[model samples]
Target: MKNAIVTGGGGGLGKSICTELSKNGYAVAVLDLKIKDAQRTSEGLENASAYAVDVRDHSSVIEFYKNYGKAPELIVNNAGIARFNKLLDQKIKDFEDVIQTNLIGSFIFASEGVRLMIKEAKKGSIINITSIHSVSPGIGVGAYSPAKAGLASLTKLMALEWGEFGIRVNAIAPGFIDSGMSKPFFENPKIRELRGKAVPLQRLGTSEDIAKTVLYLSSDAASYVNANEIIVDGGVIHSVLMHLPRE
Candidate 1:
């Protein structure tokens, strides 16, 4: 049977990705920092196991792979944190925290996951959940943009270098999703309505939207798709001017 590993699998969007993979017959390792949340996510799912893992900690990840017993067919680097503060005003520790979890954490997992794939003779998928902020900078999101941007670049480098091992590396940049870390930002109805309408699709994205994309990149259909970062932001990146006061 196939297996998959998902970081931050306990969160709202992570749960959706785990559910989709589980539904598709993959025995999923739902790794989260919170063990209870991981267990909650793994419960009622077929062949799923919950594990507490800090994606930023190399030792923690090593222990997980050792205990779990093998490499997975796919790995999703979805563990991240957002520290919203102007670059100049933010504390250095807060900035470092975001970079450590969002960027370095991904590096640790992606590299180790690839090593396992090569060792086990498995061709797999590595999906990094980057943000639109990676390309278009957002206000008050300290270090997030740089971290994601770095992740996107790292995706290309992985594809370039890991292709020899038959592994595919890609990134998915989700737009204004109404779930997970972005959920709280939408609690104010005005902000929600304003952001929703700004999308060319006239709505915000859902966890399912990102989950389906994850499945696609993991499947054989995307066998030839690699080294690419697909943007699933409902045309928001291209609609910057459309939302302006225009005739």
Candidate 2:
């Protein structure tokens, strides 16, 4: 069976991706910092295992790959954190936290995952989870936006470097997906209404919406696809400027 590794597989979109991967006949490794959550997710699947890991630590990532005992055919860098604050209100360390998790941590996992796949001479797929903020600026998302933008660039770099090994690298840029991440913003009636009105689909996206795209990219169906960004924003991003109040 094909083996897939999904970082942040313990919750929300990551868990949904694991579920879809399992359904499509892939043996999945659920890696997360939350051991209990990871184990709970794994227990729900037929061919899934949990690895309590912190993707931010290179040593832990390397050790997890070693303990996994085999190279994975697919690696999804879905572990990320968001902290929103105006530049002046944001603490330096909080900004660093966003960069460290969303960018540096992703690099560590991708570098390690590619090493393992290369050692095994395996054909592989790597999917980096970016955000709509990667392409467009958002209010109070200073660090988060830049980190995801960097991640999108990293996705292309990996695709370029790993193509020789028959490994494909791509990214999914999700907008307003209803994970715990979006809960606070959506809780306010005005905010929720505005978000819904922003999207052409008239609703926020679900984790499953992004997961379905990830599954398709990992499968043979997307065999020739590489170094691309798939936006799952429900068309909000396209007409964002149109929604701005006229001067």
Off by over 4 Å in 1: none
The deviation in Å at residue 215 for candidate 1 is: 0.3
How close to the true structure is residue 189 of candidate 2, measured as C-alpha lDDT?
85
Q: Which stretches of candidate 2 lie over 4 Å from their true place?
A: 241-247
TM-score of each prediction: 0.98, 0.95
TM-score of 1: 0.98
lDDT of 2 by residue, 134-177 (tens): 99979898699999999999999999999999999999999987
For residues 105-135, what per-residue lDDT tens digits would candidate 1 score against the true structure? 9999888888889999658889999999998
Q: What are the lDDT figures for the candidates, one per model?
A: 0.93, 0.90
